[model samples]
Structure formats: C-alpha cells, structure tokens
Target chain A: MVKLINADEAVSLFKSGQSLMIGGFLSCGTPDMVIDRLVQTALKDFTLIANDTTTPDCNRGKLISAHKIKKAIVTHIGTNPETIAQMNNGEIEVDLVPQGTLAERIRAGGAGLGGILTPVGVGTDAAQNKEIIRIDDRDYLLEKPLKADIALIYATYGDAYGNLAYDGTTRNFNVLMPLAADTTIVEVENFSDTPLDPNQVIVPGIFVDYMIVRNKHG
Target chain B: MDKDKIQEIIARRVAREFHDRDVITLGIGLPTKSIQYIPHDIQVNILSENGIFGVGSYQTEENYDPHIINAGGVGVTIKAGGCFIDSFMSFSMIRGGHIDVTVLGALQVDQEGNLANWCIPGKFTPGMGGAMDLVVGTKKLIIAMEHTAKGAPKILKKCTLPLTVAQKVNMIVTEKGVFEVTPQGLCLREISPYSSLEDIKQTTEADFITDLK
Candidate 1:
C-alpha cells in the first residue's frame, strides 16, 4: 500500500553525490514538490539521469538552480539556463545521449539488460569508440545501460495500491523508470483508497515504494 | 529566393500521406512550418510533447499562450476539450514508441538514408533534443530540408559530419525534389523545374542516380 509524506521527508532520501534518476520530460510529469524540497537542502556532487530538468520552479530544474546537480547524463539541457551556465562554467559535467538511446538505457537498467544496439550518432562524438557492431557490413552503435539508486516520478493519480497514471507528458519518464531504480517513489495528483483498474495503471504497484499526494486539477 | 515558393513546398510536404487518425510530432526550426500546412478538417491528433495534445492553429499568434508548450520548448495552442498534463509523461509517450509520424529538418542526408542536421563544420547545432527519441520511436519518419545551404549541397554521398540519427531518414523532401530511400537506392519522385540533375549533383560530391517519378 502507498503512504503519503511531506516534501522534506521525501527529498531527504536523496543525499549529495548520489546517483539519482529524476523522472519527467519538461514540466509535465515532474515531481515538483520533491524537487522544491531539495532547493534548500544544499546538496551537491550528484550524478543525475534525466531527459531534462523541469523548467525553473516547475520540476527538478529547481535542483539545478540550487546547484544541486554536479553532472547529468541526459538527452537535452537547453531549457535549463542554469544547467547551461553551470556546464559552460565547468561547474557540471554533461553527457549528452541520443534521446531514444537514453530511454533504452533506462529501460535496460530496469530490465537487467547490460547494453543495447542503436544507429544514433554512429559517426559523431556520441559514438567515440564506445563499441562498434556490424550487420550486413553496415555499422551500428552499442550503447550501455544506466541505472539509479533512487527514482522520483510523477503521475496523474494513484490508489492506495500504488498504481500510477500519468496525466500527459509527465508520463515520459514515469512509465519505464520505476523498474529501473532500486527505489522508486511516486508523487500523484490524487491518492485514493479504491484500487485502480488493471489497465489504467501506467505503472503497477509492484515497482513503487512510496507515494505522495497532490491536487493537480483542483 | 521567393517566399511563395517556400510556403508552397512547406505546405505540400506537411500534409503527406499517412493514417488519417494517427498521432503526429513535429520537430523545431523549419519543420515548425508544418503546423501551418495541416488541413483543418483532418482528425489527426497534433501533439506537442511539452504537454499539450489536440494542439490548435499556429497562424493566429493570439491563440498561443505561455502555459501551452510543446516538446520543442515553444509556446503552442491547445484545441477545445483539451487537457493539460505533465510533460514527463509526454516523453514517456515518445520513449514507448506511441508516436506515429515524426517530421524533422535535416542538415545533410547521405546515400544510406542517414541524417546530419545537428552539426556541421565542427560547430554544434542545437544537439539532439528529442529527435533521436522521436525518430527511433515513431512508427514512420520523414526529413525536410533546403536542398543546399550557402550553395553547398546539404545532401551528400556520405555524411562527412556528425549526425543526429543514422539510417533514420526514410524520405527526403527538399525544395528541389521528393525522394524516398529504399533498399534499392536514392529514388527521386519530384524535382523543382528550376533545378536539374546536374544542379543537385553540383551542390555536393555525393553519388547520384536518377529515378524520376
């Protein structure tokens, strides 16, 4: 069953320098409250796996603004001006991944797959001799998977059963990441007592460890 | 050289053949023009990965509001009965291959259906953003670009540069022609009357064969 907790307690699970996977694409599906709690925590030396930190004050971007992230293995960071500033100033290290490959790596991490094959950035720096595999005498790139100690995700709603439903874009990372992390926490708009319909839960209860409640529509 | 020509090309390509009720994703930059081309009566769902589905008209600037944004990180308009959700899940839709047709712009297209729209001459273009995910995950993909930039061909025999995605370019629509890449080779379907085979070949040193359709 899921339990509700305050933002501070939820964010406390994350410590500085820890390898974390923060789920959300941009603003949608972001664990804003958890990220907000981290703003004042003054943590650093963290390795982050994300698509992009949410917009300032919206999602995990608050963490970036607070200088909490030391490095990011992500697809894009253009929206987070602070992230850009930190990277340009050498305060943070950014490993840009192909969007699909990054998602696959996360999925692989969850599924116990060590690596995957792809055709993104084969001749570019994105493939700096990581590994080259050939099929039909044509080249494809081998990409390694990534995992996290903790994964924080957002969903539209959940039940006491810990089933997850993403409202919109918020489902981006929430769908596949819970299984990829050692611990996955959910922040849902509505937390109810009724068990969700089996088909309605974007994420099943088995992968979730905790749930936080919020009112998104109200 | 003419605004009318650019608009015509942009319009025709955006409304390409596809399932009538599939979900569509549009990339940023020139590909943005595609929004203007979609027919109003079409029932297809136009989604902005930022967070909005059932996105509305792009022509009326008044229709755009700050709260409605697409995955490209730009403001957009939402249609009636639209619901705003979170963007994190929007990306989940992409990662899970829920997208139907994803149209994007390219910098270079090589003989083997590869694309290099993110960088050139060692200078970075806006990195891969959501493109790799959209291309690999979308059911089908298309690339649109100017035939050449600065009089040099953007299409080449081999992308002698960094690429955003490889072998993901299923079709190429330049101002000059519409070409479909297949197991056979670069097969041409249309060419602007103003340009010739020599004109395209002269733009880049890529090998070419004519399959005029």
Candidate 2:
C-alpha cells in the first residue's frame, strides 16, 4: 500500500550519505516539491543518480549547486555550470555514464538480472579496465546493474494506491526508477481517490511506497 | 567559403548518403542539420536518444510541447506512425544493432577511421552522451564535421586527443569532400565543387588513397 505524505514528511525519510535515483531529464519530470523540501534539509554526502543535474537553479541542480551532493552518476551536466565547477575543483565526485547504459543498468537492477552485456564502449576509454566477455567472436563490456536506497519520481496522475500515469515525456525515467529502488516516492500533479485506468497506469502501485500531491505541474 | 556555407555544403553532401528505408540516428551538431538537406523523396526514420522515433521537423511556438522535445531538447513533431518510448527501449534499438546508420560530428578522424570527438584533454567536456553507443551499435557510422577548426585539419594521420571509438567510422563528409574508410585506408571519394585534389591534399593531414573512380 502507498501512503500519501507531504513533501516535508517525504524529506524526513532521507538521511545523509544515502543513495537516490531521481527521475527527470532537464527538469521535465523532476519532483520539484520534494526537491524544494530536500534542499532545506542538512543532508550532505548524498549520492545522486540522475540523467543530468538539469540547471543550476532547477531540480537536482539545486542540491548540486548547494554542495549537498557528494557524488553524481549522470550522462550530462553542461547546463549546470555549478556541477562542472565542482567537478573540476574536486568538490563533487562525478561518474559520467552513457545515457543508454545508465538506463539499462537501472532496468537490470529492477529485473534482478546479474548484469548486461553491451558493446557500447568497446574501443573507447570507457572500455579500459572493464570486464570483456566474448560471444561468437564478438566482444562486449559487462556493465553492472544499479539500485539505490530511494527513488524520487514524478507522476502526472496518481491514485491513493499509487498507480501512476505520466504526461508526454515526463514518463522518461519515472517508470523505471521505482522498480530499481528500495523505497519509491512520487510527486504527482493530481491525487485521486478512485483508481486510474488500467491502460493508463504506467506504474503499478505495488512498486510505489509513498506519494506527495502537488496538484500542479512543475 | 563562409562558415555557414561550409556547414550547409557539408550537410547537403551528407544527406545524399541515406537510403530510403534506413533507420538512422543523428547526433546534435552538424549531423542534426543534415535532416533539412535530405532529399524529399527518401523515406527514412529518424531516431532520437531521448525516446523519440520518426522525429519530424521543428514545431511552431504555439504547437510546442515542452515534454515533447528531441535529444537535443528542441521541440519537434512526430512523423506519421512514429511512436514514443522510454530511454531503455530507445537504447535497446541502438545497442541491439537495430539502427541501420548513425551520423555524428567528430573533432578528429584519423587515417584508420578512429574518432576523437567526446573530449579534448585538459578541457571541460559534458561527457559522452550516445556517441559511443551509436558508433559501436550502428551498422554504418557516418562522420560529418567541418574540414578544420581554427586552421587545424580535423582529418588527421592519427588523432592527438582521446578517441571516442577506434576504427568504427565508415564514411567521412566534410565541407571540402567525402572520404570512405576502406579496409586498405582512407580513400578520397568525392571532392566538393569548391576544392580540387591538390587543395584536399594541402588541407588534410591524413594520407588518403585517391580512388576517384
């Protein structure tokens, strides 16, 4: 069952040095209310797993610019100059993963697979020192699965039971993060008493643990 | 030629390489501009790493949907029969060798078809997005870039910077010419109307086999 909670209460669940998977791409699907609440917390040394830090004044980038993030595993951070500055200055440890590989690793974690065999980084520096397995004379890099303590996702519509519906591209990572986290919290634009349409529900409430209602789009 | 004309020349030339039913992906820089130059008769599907397939032309401001942008974060329309998916499925199409071709921008392309595009040592790069994946996964890899940057030849004998992938590129298209990466070596295929064989030799640092047949 999913419990409906406020943003402040959701923020209370987080602690320092924890790992989090935040669902967003350039602020489209980010949990703004939860991010706003998390910014007020004194938590530091948190490991963030996301697409990008977004912008310096937006979403996960706010935590990054505030120096709350100790480490970030992301695809790009060009828009967030603060992240680049911090990375260059060694204030934040950045692990840049290919966007596809990052998505598959999270998918693998949720699916309980050992790891995925990919040829994406074969001849690049990304392949250096990584395990290579050959099948039928072709080589692949063994990318490991990834999971986190918590996953913060945004939903356009969610029920009390936590069934989630997303609008347009906002469904980017929100559908997958829940499957890859120990606890999944959603920030939603609409809170409903009745269930969402079965065909419309992209994420089943079973994977979701908590919901924060915004009733407004970010 | 002026820089914009150079880019236009490169874009127009690169657009000729596509076949009618090719499932192609284009990178953000010069390759993205190639779409406008593609022949109107050819029917090809354009895939975006940001979960869009069959990406169409730009949207008007009134029709713009923020949640419906391409990998480059530009608002685009979806072609008929185009479907939306998450990143996981999109990459599956890439890494599973389902994409027919991928066109990308390169910083440097060596004689052996090695690409060094993601970074320049001691400089800040946003990091490799889907360049590595597309190069490794696509059946054909086409590199579209300027002939030179700041008076330095981008086509080189050997890339001085870190490589994105080694010996993966199949074709190279520049403002001045087109080169094919054959098993023997880089072969000069076509020269632009603006340049001759002597001019190409003078500009490019890489040793290419001139098989202009």
DockQ of each: 0.33, 0.66
Worst 10 residues of 2 chain B by lDDT: B121-130
For model 1 chain B, the run of ten residues with the poorest summed lDDT: B118-127
What tens digits encode model 2's per-residue C-alpha lDDT throughout B1-213? 788899899989888988898999999978999999889899999998877889988889878876677887778888998987777888889888899989999889999999998877558578787777788889999999988888889999999887888889899999888999999999999998988999899889999999885
Candidate 2, residue B79: the lDDT equals 90
Q: TM-score of predicted model 2? A: 0.96
lDDT per residue (tens digit) for residues A66-154 in model 1: 78888888887766777777777889888888766777788888899988877656656788868999988866788887889889887
DockQ of 1: 0.33
Please tell me which predicted candidate would have the highest DockQ against the true structure. 2
lDDT for B25 (candidate 2): 97
Q: Please report how far candidate 1 places residue A68 from its true position, in Å.
A: 1.7
How many residue pairs clash per model? 25, 0
lDDT of each: 0.72, 0.87
* Candidate 2 global Cα RMSD: 1.7
TM-score of chain B of 1: 0.84
- Model 1 spans with C-alpha error above 4 angstroms: A54-58, A119-124, A132-141, A215-218, B1-8, B17-25, B35-70, B73-102, B120-125, B133-141, B150-152, B167-170, B179-189, B193-211
* Candidate 1: residue B67 lDDT (0-100): 37
Give me candidate 2's interface root-mean-square deviation: 1.4
